[model samples]
Target: MGRDTSSAMVEHLDFFQSFDDVKVYYDNGQNIVKQALDRSVGKVLSKVVVRRRKTSMAGYRLEQVADYLSTIELALVKYEAKEDGETYNKFFGGIGSFKRNWLKQARCKRI
Candidate 1:
């Protein structure tokens, strides 16, 4: 089954609650994202702005950084589960190095 979009959106918004304002950019699923944003409640709704942009046309460096962070997070998950380590290894050398170099630093900047 597909993931629950509404719940996912709420969780993501919750993660950024400390921020005074948030601007979200996505390449697809604009309708789903907008509907989720509309349904959201609390102070976070006031802080968030969702914008749709084609990835190819997105010249923002933040967009690329977000994508890289997301990929690293997914790779970490897969690595821990023993499902996939190729990506983690290719980019980070090994699990020890991944945790020491990337994971620690990434956690500090997590949104």
Candidate 2:
């Protein structure tokens, strides 16, 4: 049996509570968080494929794929912004206490 990678991933990110910490950890060259997420999504996709082969779950797979795509896109945005010299909050507007209280831009910027 394959390992339930969703739990593995959730366990991996046990420290970070916001995108700021996530970006910090990621910028510090520790990518296991996002890597875990990717691995989990891959596992879920494989499970979806197996399920689809056995029966019809097209709608569930479609939703799962959409969610995974959005998650990947968000991670890319944060990674690119961090690489481009922007703080996590400045780039993605994390819901940390400091950022939420202070950095709420009147107009949201496009990623």
Q: Best lDDT goes to which candidate?
A: 1
Which run of 10 residues does model 1 get worst, by summed lDDT? 38-47
User: How do the residues 16-48 of candidate 1 rate in per-residue lDDT, one tens digit apiece?
Assistant: 766765555545457766555544532335434
**Which residue segments of model 2 deviate by more than 4 Å?**
1-29, 47-101, 104-111
Model 1 CA RMSD to the hidden true structure, in angstroms:
7.2
Q: What does candidate 1 score on TM?
A: 0.44
lDDT of 1 at 53: 40
Clashes by residue pair, model 1: none
TM-score of each: 0.44, 0.23
lDDT of 2 by residue, 1-111 (tens): 124556654566544333332211112134666565445545643433322123344536755555545654554555556542346456554445323442333213224
Question: Model 2: which residue pairs collide?
Answer: none
